[model samples]
Target: MSLYDEVGGAAAIDAAVDGFYGKVLADPLLSPLFASMDMTAMRRKQKMFFAAVFKGEANGADGYMRSAHKRLVDDGLIGDAHFDAVALHLQATLEDLSVPGHLVRQIMTAAAGLRNAVLNR
Candidate 1:
């Protein structure tokens, strides 16, 4: 089965997204970065991002990217440190859920690509 099938599609992705954001928001260093947005919107965008990722569809992710995180660096909300924290939290989340290492690596790699684009440091 493809990684997409292993991920259990949208329902699993939604659950994972919720769990991921819960971890992010609970971390003091990260929550403040999200203080300006409505949690509902964040949740929706996260679901969309995860859906695209696990479904092997990324073309539309740019819309969510633009809306959810385009200002991450510009607004001084995220930098290298924040990216590391996010990576750590996400890996822990996947580990906690017993997701396969391959799937986890895919997520980390994809996130790293975004991190490089934003941090550039």
Candidate 2:
């Protein structure tokens, strides 16, 4: 089963995204990066991104991730540490939602694989 379905599909992703942003916005290290972002748009994109990834239909995700963060990477606002922080927040969000540990690990592994793309390396 896809991770999206395994974790309860759209509803789960929605909750996870909301929970993730709640933590991220509260995090001093991560919050500043989103100071002027259009959160509604950001959240919408996140939902679409996660849905595509979890559904195994992320055809252009790598390129998308690279382009999406290119500016931040160029400005030095994004780096390994920031990526790790985001990953940690994602993991915590999944756990907080009571997702099974095995699935969480699977999801995290997939996320980790995107590190290079996200970091624009």
Local distance difference test scores for all models = 0.76, 0.94
Worst 10 residues of 1 by lDDT: 60-69
* Tens digit per residue, CA lDDT, model 2, 5-50: 9999999999999999999999999999999999999999999999
Error of 1 at 82 (Å): 0.6
lDDT, candidate 1, 1-121, per-residue tens: 6556787777767677778888999999999888887988878877776766766778755454545565676777777788899889888888877788988898888877776555633
TM-score to true structure, per model: 0.82, 0.97
Output the lDDT of residue 7, model 1: 71
Q: In candidate 2, which residue ranges exceed 4 Å CA deviation?
A: none
Candidate 1 residue spans exceeding 4 A from truth: 60-68
Which window of 10 residues has the lowest lDDT sum in candidate 2? 1-10
